[model samples]
Target: MAKWGEGDPRWIVEERADATNVNNWHWTERDATNWSSEKLKELLMGLWVEGEEGKCEITEVSKVE
Candidate 1:
């Protein structure tokens, strides 16, 4: 662990008027729900499976939530 007032330089965030995450020490969140849903629907919509007896196909993706 780093001592008080003597933290590693790479882990320090520079002082600025806007306290942005320059060093990226703080966690950030991004909303990719819609994008992930759409990507899943696209990838799963036309998937198909075949067996010795029968075959199956995914014609539509109704919901991906």
Candidate 2:
């Protein structure tokens, strides 16, 4: 192991006044609920499937949760 003050720089955590994540290395939280719901609805709606004498279509996506 390297000595206390001679360790690799990448392993060191820099001091910050706000104590935020350094270099965005940590996991950050984001709210995507509305965006994901809309995206799912857009992708699911208007889909159609046909096989032999059967056919089905997704005309509307009411909820995605």
Candidate 3:
């Protein structure tokens, strides 16, 4: 949901991390350069979707992350 891929949507869903903590991740191009395609994409997804307040949080808890 972070809308990782730049040009299009891939429907690749992933888990969500702690909303208030970006402690371990280094969300930058350098860090992503070494990642596998899937891994890099996941990171990208993590970038924008992590903070969405209502879009993903409802009725049931998000199973992501």
Candidate 4:
């Protein structure tokens, strides 16, 4: 696996007052879903489980539909 922070700079989201929400977030590419599987996994490295009781890392992800 590749190291973290070793991808395109355009994917990086720097802090900005106006870009606080998802709607105003800046991006170099328009298609946000064009990321690779590895990139997607890396982006979601550490995450708490939703609709659960305790805190935990998200080991897997699946589509509901």
Per-residue CA lDDT of model 4 for 1-23, tens digit only, reads 33576766766555578656566
Best by TM-score: 2
For residues 1-65, write the lDDT of model 2, one tens digit per residue. 87768878887765579979866678676899999999888888888999999999999887787
Q: What's the CA error at residue 36 for candidate 4, in Å?
A: 1.2
Error of 1 at 36 (Å): 0.5
The lDDT for every candidate, in the order shown, is 0.81, 0.83, 0.44, 0.59
Candidate 3 lDDT over residue span 1-65, tens digit each: 24445533564333467543244454423444434665655555534334545444223323334
Q: Count the backbone clashes (under 3 Å) in each candidate.
A: 0, 0, 5, 0
Supply the global lDDT for candidate 3.
Answer: 0.44
Report model 1's TM-score to 2 decimal places: 0.58
- Using TM-score as the yardstick, the better of models 1 and 3 is 1
Q: In candidate 2, list every pair of residues with a backbone clash.
A: none
Instruction: List where candidate 1 sits over 4 angstroms from the true fold.
Output: 1-27
Which is superior by lDDT, 1 or 3?
1
Error of 3 at 63 (Å): 26
Once model 1 is optimally superposed onto the true structure by TM-score, how far is the C-alpha of residue 45 displaced, in angstroms? 1.2
